[model samples]
Target chain A: MKEATTSKIAWGWLALAAVFLVYPLVFQSAFFRDIGVLLLLAAISASAWNIVGGYAGQVSVGHGMFFGVGAYVPLMVFTHLGWPPLLGVPIAIVVVLVLSVIVGMPTFRLQGHYFSMATLAVAELIRLLVGTWDFAGAAIGLSGPAIPRGWWDLTFTSELPYYYIFLGVLATLLLVTWQVQRSRFGYYMRAVKAGERAAKSLGVPVRRTKLFALMLSAAFTSIAGSLYAIKTGFVDPESGFGILVSVQMLIIAALGGAGTLIGPLIGAIILIPLQTATNTWFGGGGSGLTYILYGGIIVLLARFEPGGLVELWNTYAPRRWRSGSHAP
Target chain B: MLLEAKNVAKHFGEFRAVADANLTVAEGDVIGLIGPNGAGKSTFFNCLAGDTEPTAGTILFDGQDVTNASTETHARLGIGRTFQVPATFEDMTILENVMVGAFMRHPGRADARAHAEKIIEMTGLREHAHLRARSLGTPGRKRLEIARVLATGPRLMLLDEALAGLTPGELQQAITLVRRIHETGVTLVIVEHIMEVIMTLTARVLVFNQGHVIASGKPQDVVKDPLVIEAYLGHGHGKRARKRGPAA
Candidate 1:
């Protein structure tokens, strides 16, 4: 019986992968491809946040620090060192690693709301500093390759390449998340989420587990940030290290179901288009109406279903369709 | 000796929770620690289990000095323990809850799962392996805590009120489980309020009063100690209770 259910899940994932691969080709429109790119980017970063926030229960609210670094380092290297922005990815990863350790070490000790506040303060500090630092284009910010220097510049007229690139990265991130869910580290992460003291009594190295998760999460968010810079062709302190960017990651993962795998994708599926296309569809006076819709849904979900839409699905999903083992 | 404590003391500012407490355990022994409420029984148990650091003294486990070690280090060094209140991971199923402890020995998921499954079966939680821990009653949650510790494959186990708040049938089952565990040769140090557990299971007993070890001997003898009788039965009642113990 268990084997049958496991295979059923396997089939479901394979079918989803097939859809992702063919999504752009089937749609064949630039606008549709743009939505595809946004969807993938949203999913990638949100899934990254799920590691520390959802599984490890670290609840960092300043992930934009890593994201900003990711966006800036690539462009900084391009203009000063005359290297391709994509090649600067390794430097971005290294810098993000250093920052993650610094941010996680003391803040992780504070825990809960304190950790969130610390992360937010650090992210805001970085943003203000970047606004003044002339080396990073100061407040005006930096721009990527104007004319197509080459394929490596990632500058293009169509969103097709970006759609594919972002899709590939998202797929890789999902595969890593899948492996984590089945590993011993995954068990330790969940244990820490429940209670650190009890988890420690069970022989789990709680601090080390939280640190590992934060570092991994920051790295992936950096990659997504790099992708964002590549696609948008510009990144300022506001665009790269914006508070909205961080909150968006948290919301996307949470409202879709924070802890469960693929929750971010579901979140991006509903939110990205909803947030972007609301003005046209609703014929409203811009983002004011969108915020109400977004905030309203979040309020309802937080008050009624803290577990998010995934819990709703688990509770209401058909018997065979439900994740059988977790049904209780 | 499999375990030894030399004047282990835990002090909270001016208040002493466990002061100058000492005990030793042989490789396959089962011992009991008993006292009236606020007699510091749980505090002494915490000091020995490494959850609370001793203000002074030494602890040796398996011939190695483990004084000042953290609870995680103790667990890694083959000392497993259950909390007074069941701290079962509410989000996980019974098997998953046990798997967290099993991961200490078996790093791989498959091996950990197999080991955890064996522990759950041994603790009689096989029927509830798929059920979330939040759904369980007090008895099952306590057993879950025991099963979780058992998965660590500890050389010594510290059980804090494992048999408390149970129905008669549940108590019998829990006692049986403890006996099955003892038969496997795991050294056990139990902190229990029920004299029946000490009378029937423990070979030796230690009595605590006002954060000090007032008496130590065979369960029957310890129960008859004048200081212990006074601690439990009070100053006036102790005189009349000297002829009888909680159990003969």
Candidate 2:
């Protein structure tokens, strides 16, 4: 049975890989590849958010702080020092680690919706602060390298390279998430999510586990932000630290299945295309629709099925496949 | 002694949940705490299990002081416990529920899974290993509580009314399961509402009345203590106590 499961998983991954491999070649359009890149980026960010919100149940709505810094630092560094924007990725990760600790310490100390509220508050605070900071380009924001100085500069006219790059990053993030799912820490994360008191009784270090999860999540979210800047060649306080920026990751993760491995990816698959389509059809006016769509799904899912699409998939999928998506 | 709680009192603001609790548990000895409703049996149990810190007291586990230690620290120091409400990870399967505890010692997923499987089998929950914990009723969840605690490889285990709502047959099975676990050399401290369980399972009994150890001795003698009768069993409970058979 174990061998069969293993083989099935391998096949699943190969199939997933095949889709990514074939998409660009078949579509052969910049628009499609841009959508692909955006979808993967959203998936990466959502997956990172899942480490804290989904797997560990921290439910942070302020991940835009990590993402904003990630997007901002690289571009801001380039604008200030004329250095390669990619160099700021590591700096962004370190900054996110410190920020996560600062955020996690106080919020994790108090259980329940406090973490979510604190995250939302922090993200907005950062946005407001960034809106005034002249060094980091203030509300106007910063731009990436004006022109590619070298191959390392990562500036590209084609969306294809960004698509592959994002796919690689998303794959890496998924791999890490899978490791967490199967590891001892992953088990602890679920235990912590179940109930802090029960988790404590079961020998799970609840507070510490949450802190670590937030840090891990923050780091990846920062990386995703950096990637966004690298691709877009620009960053503004509104784009970098916007509430919608933070909320999108949460919405996608919740829509798919908050804690499941492929939940964010599935959510990205469904939500991103719809998002791109509406934005294209409506031009700049699609932002309001996105909010309405997100709010509607959140309310409906919260009331009807907080377990999200993954739970539905688990219950409705073939008997053999039901065991694959373990919901927690 | 494997465990000791000296003058432990839990006060929530001005109201004292447990006024004073002193208990010592020797290694390999099984003990029971029985009390009338609101006599603070569960509260004292929580104090002993490190679920709640006492307002004033010291707790020694395996000769080390751990009065203010967190619940995880207690577990790491070879102590494990079950909640009165039968706490189980709702979204997890029975096997995964046990595996979470097994991870305390096993650390590796495969090892934890193996240990959890063995625990599930021992607890007679093998058939339900893959079923979500939320699907379980009270008795099943109580059994899961035991399975999860047992998976932690504890030297001492505390059970809080684990058999409270079980049917007669389920109670018998649960008693047998606890006996089987006792035979494995883990010391046990249980809070129980059932007299039959106390008489059959515990080596000694501590009778609580209004947050105090009003009476304590072998189950047969302790039940007859006048203070225990007046406080717990009410006025004329001695005759009924006498009718019950000796400890098993």
The candidate that achieves the highest lDDT relative to the unseen native structure: 2
- Model 1, A1-328: lDDT tens digits are 6678789989988998899889999998988888889999999999999999988888888999989999999899988988889987879999999999998888777656877898999999999999999999999999988997788899989888899899899999999998997799998999999888889888999888999999999999999999999789889998899888898898899889887887888999999988878866767566577558668878988799887888788778886777655644
| lDDT measured at residue B165 in model 2 versus the true structure, 0 to 100 | 95
Candidate 2 C-alpha lDDT tens digits along B104-123 = 99988889999999999999
> What local lDDT score does residue A214 receive in model 1, on the 0 to 100 scale?
94
Least accurate stretch of 10 residues (summed lDDT) in model 2 chain B? B239-248
Cα lDDT listed for each candidate: 0.89, 0.90
Clashing pairs in 2: none
Model 2: per-residue Cα lDDT at residue B210: 78
Candidate 1: deviation at residue A4, Å?
2.2
Per-candidate TM equals 0.96, 0.96
